[model samples]
Target: MSAPCDNQTGGPERPSFVTDDELERALRDAFARRVATPRPLAADPAGLAVRRARRVGRRRTLTGLALAGVATALVTTGVAQLGAPAGRDGTPIVVLGDPRGSSPSPLPAESTAAAPAAGPVRPELDLIVGSWLYTNGGERWELTGVSTVERAQRVPDRGGWLLTSAVTAAGRTLWWVPPNGRPPQVLLAGADAIAVAADGRRVAWRDGGEVFAAGAVAGQLLATTRAAAPAGAVPVGFAGDTVLIRQPGRGGFRVWHSPTEDRLGTVNRDVLNVYGVRPDGLVVGQVSAGTPRRPCLALLDPARELAPVRTGCDPELATDGRGDVSADGRWLLVNGARNAALLVDLDALGSGGSGQSAGPALTGVVTWTRAGAALHVDAAGALVRVRPEEVTAGEQPFSSPVDGVAPGDRPVVVADSRP
Candidate 1:
């Protein structure tokens, strides 16, 4: 009778991480006579096939994910680019092989006081502190200007949200490295809510109950807070620095949150994958708490305001891209079943060709990022790394790894900054 979880860090949104055969079998029986598999993407080709069910599959069996990927290959959105590989939907996929991602901290969250008005806590901004990519050989990015609040109102300094700060920055640094704290007894630092930062000066992590930020010391705890959630909150997923969770207030609802447990947006609708959350704040979920039928994918917003995204891409590909985007919020590098892939910018207008041209070929699911928006194509000895800010519009923007090597083949994150 409680709300379902939508945490991106593979929370309830993904069912139970105990992806063992037992859990799978239990989940299977729960919906044995009620669930129905949807058609494959190959059938509609351009259109993505939407399946309906209360839960995709037990974490033990990502039957939905496997089948979904299988459908992607069979159906390509035959839609060409405006200028070939320039900005084929600028997206940033989840960076696999994240060094610090090695050890998951705990889950962070706040209790919903006694009453709803007992002062519901709000969310704040989460910053990247340390990681293998940054410490090894990359640029460090900081997350600042975040605070907590109630509802969708901005408080900026409610003091309930968590925050992290650094004293300096390094030119070649990739992430921050701390000194202590790593266990699963409480919450597993699984998935990602993990990163050290490119400057190698900060520490950020999710400690299950709530998010925490620190400077040079791991146990030094910078700040911590809970999500703008009700008493019965369900975690769906975690994206970039955000967490997707569901709770029961007036009724069942969904929303995006920060590591410190702050609400960024909300989805007041019903969906099937209520258990799914993408990276870019886009939710691939559903809620039938008060409804009478099975579940389906529903795009949710943090504030339950307007439609989530309407750009050239949106609700688009959260999982790095689609089922993908619900977590990272980009599509530059997406994760696939076999290999990681890239979303190449197709310029049908300029390249003067109708077919795919010579540029970059992502080896994984296409992912993207907004700040350092660069097209990284790792394929066929052609490393296309183009910073969108540096090029002119329609320049067939592309980027390949140093040697056109598929980074997907080997999760690379600028590691080497060790003792």
Candidate 2:
């Protein structure tokens, strides 16, 4: 849970939450306090140095022990089998840390898991209507097939989706559901997290505490390249050819060029969590900085050390990393206070206008369609399309129900859905 908003900053304060590192430290200190007796092993300077090194190693071992205990507790309670819950408004929630505490070692490059048997492909598709994939009560649903995929992202050019299995003791399987509908091919196994480029031409994933990148060509992954990353790093999204890796429990992110494996440096110190990246390279995230530490939705320039290009501050607004920017980077869908979903106009916000005061908040997860309309799930789990003019005029934007799709399913539209 987030801390109370500070009036001095005119926005929400940075969430005061505990981190894994802090928890480990507390556990170590408590264990030390119970040591009952101290052995005198450091009378000489050299002996003291050896003792200090041993203590450090012991702390490291204790961290691993603590994480193992956490994993055991989760499995015992069946929490590990549960998927992340959607927000009250239907926005998907983003959790930062791996349940196992640290990333698993990376699998061999040739170690691809066997692909599942392919289903029959549809004869034709309406690209204009687009496609969306989401999981409903443990079933992964797409227009052409259904499976047990826990998370999915659209591969626009490939006409399919990239899928990841639910967390397991071994790790998650990364699969590619082809447009031709042959079957889903396994791209990699034992992956911790995955991120695809905006164009669907490139892909990146984290495994074994390292970040790997590869080109997505003709429904197949090209040769893979690996780069070392900081501890607890996970690939969040891509900025052009650069991969943006978020450091769990830390306020900043690392920008690394995929092809060259160059560490561009860290960014977004004031931004707590990133939602999405704009086409022009501006990062959309929750910023909590400036005098008095105001929290708000901000556009941060990655090249400028994450300086705010524009800020939309609202005292009542709160985000759990459950929002996204439109294809044109003009509209933003974010979950507002009281579970209200808001459609924010970036152009207006840049022109000295306010998003919270400009339009009424609706109830559902709102996303942008290819035709520039707002497609959302209503309270009854129905699909509703809203025109751009209706959003600007503060009028009721419900247009019609989307046909042939089940209700109560979250929809993921392509990001660049500009007219």
Candidate 3:
């Protein structure tokens, strides 16, 4: 298969979330460093570097540990697997990473796994790739090929990529919030609210006004809920078994925790929507109860609601349930901009009250942090860099720190990376 043409050398084995100019500068520095070193070390330093690089590069290539950021490397392996179906032409599908790679030997558009009994067996929906949209009735299906320019829906309740769309999947037309909005079982009525994770299995969205969820399983009621009972304020997404509901009081907006299936909540009237969440009770969202429309997000440690991590901006709850949002970085405690926010001038924030940024704002940021490990994502929700404060000396179970691992789509295996 034809491979991507990346001639960059030196610097960190992998590129971090640096601006293109920064990357270019880094590459230049690497080149200068190579030039500065005495006569290519022993024989030819360039050749030696390639040998060393190939070793580490091959390791990164094999592991595929990084989150989805850009399409730089995604084209290497799966290009062969991207041939046109019976009817469609072989239009090169632009994945999460950059499309500068060489044309790949297309593969039969069939999944290595058994084809779903209902439809074509996709290897798996790359959260960064197009999604399988379903209708409320589940009768028709459509593919809104994913792109970076499109606007993204966001919701705080979910902890992943916010994949919001009005498309249909299978035979059903569904309105999803984020993450994987078009699952067979979910129906995010009212304003769309959904979020898909980097792993794909953990889908979160609003259903009938209340939060609900389903695993990547084709047809399973992961979690279900009614909007709100007694005409209480509607609920949004789900934080594990707890639902993020809007409370009712004077100008109320709160996160009233209820059983996974509970549609109602005790009136707290302090929280906004569950904008973003993580397995570790780190929940963030807007606080609107007292503030009303001027809502600000609060990051809650779910275990302790009163003292959640509060930010100065509002996080949108995406239709796909992925914690994809316009993390109004204008404020000190910024999350991330909406997936589509990338389309905006990276400097728009700076000139305006938003925030001043150099180059593409998305170019230099990390979206998620766990333990001591950090993964950086670009405008397209691809994981471009992995910064592990301490790289394990030997080969541990590490994954490649590349582009295109959108948040929420959790990799099933242990994520090992070349530190």
Candidate 4:
């Protein structure tokens, strides 16, 4: 039998299949031959990889340069926007953020840019120009002009200056210094007292008991009108067209209509003295005796028969008839007890708030500027600038020794026009 005939009469059935071990050996040999024979490469594989890397680096470098250009353009635009236009004379206008003298240093990589340096502090037009007049060393001096008179008053509108000189046995001679730099002209020969309007357009003076009102124009008086004032009345100031006359030995003031010569009304007798008048015709006064009994600063409305519009009382408030309101009628600075000054916010007072003590304990007088800064001449003759907004109790204002003023010399500032 051919291998015992696996199937019925199959003659060894079929060719014998390979064993499992033999098949595994054949597969391993095939794999070994395929690995031994090297495959064909399109190019040097290592060189191709290096070239690809170089191309990617070039692309990254180009992208970095493009981003830097965009950043530079944005910075240039920002600088142009911050710059201000030049003046007509080709001088650059001084703006708030412009660098002074030298360029600023660059900021650190992680730090934010610092705030711009503050510009130099400058006085307002009333303080800068010819308005500031003071006396020093027995000689008078205009802040911008030469020493000329013993006392000077600036016109509120900068029309000119009212100067007092030649005090004779008769009375004080009033002179008008024209704003155009012309020689001063004589305004009145013998004026006992003088008061200028808030607008500097009208002027009133007293020759004995007779009060006169005239239009102040170009350093000359026009349209003069005269009216006999109440007995013992002295011209103090002008509230619009009305003339404010204080009666000596009396505790109140009287309002006189200059044009009509009609005695309008009287301020309340409770107001001990009229310190000053605001631009809006409100009178600032002191009430020494009242229901509260404490000395207080009272803002009186003349239209309402001098009724108290607002009152701020403090035991330390001592008014020696030296006080003023800001031109905008917002601030009131009154002389206080112990040589200090009190700053009252009219808005706050109207809303029922208290006053604040301002500046150092100055031995000298405190006056307000048209720009609302309190000007105080300290004991050391330092011209101190007190900002009302910055003033707090027991705080000192900025003090600077004025040039040409000695350390011990006290300078008296011109009044009324500064309100």
Ranking by lDDT: 4, 2, 3, 1
The RMSD of every model to the true structure, in order and in angstroms, is 29.8, 26.0, 23.9, 29.4
Worst 10 residues of 1 by lDDT: 146-155
Tens digits of per-residue lDDT, candidate 2, 331-360, equal: 776667656556777766645555542233
User: Which of 3 and 4 is ahead in lDDT?
Assistant: 4
- Mind giving the per-residue lDDT tens digits that candidate 3 earns over 1-419? 74554657435545567774665555556765857646544565445655675677766664454433323443544422222112223221212221233222332332233322442212112222233322212222333333221222222333222343342332112222223322212222233344443343444444332344444222222332233433335434445545454444433444435434344444545554454444454555545432445544455555454354544432332222222222232112123344321111121322333321112233322233223333334444343322222222222212233222335432111111111
Given candidate 4, what's the lDDT at residue 228? 63
TM-score of each: 0.29, 0.57, 0.34, 0.58
Clashes of each: 136, 5, 114, 0
Question: What's the TM for model 2?
Answer: 0.57
Best by TM-score: 4
**Clashing residue pairs in candidate 2 (N, C-alpha, C atoms within 3 angstroms):** 104-208, 118-182, 118-183, 327-415, 327-416
lDDT of each: 0.30, 0.56, 0.35, 0.57
Model 3 residue 256 distance off true place after TM-score fit, in angstroms:
5.5
Any idea how many clashes model 2 has? 5
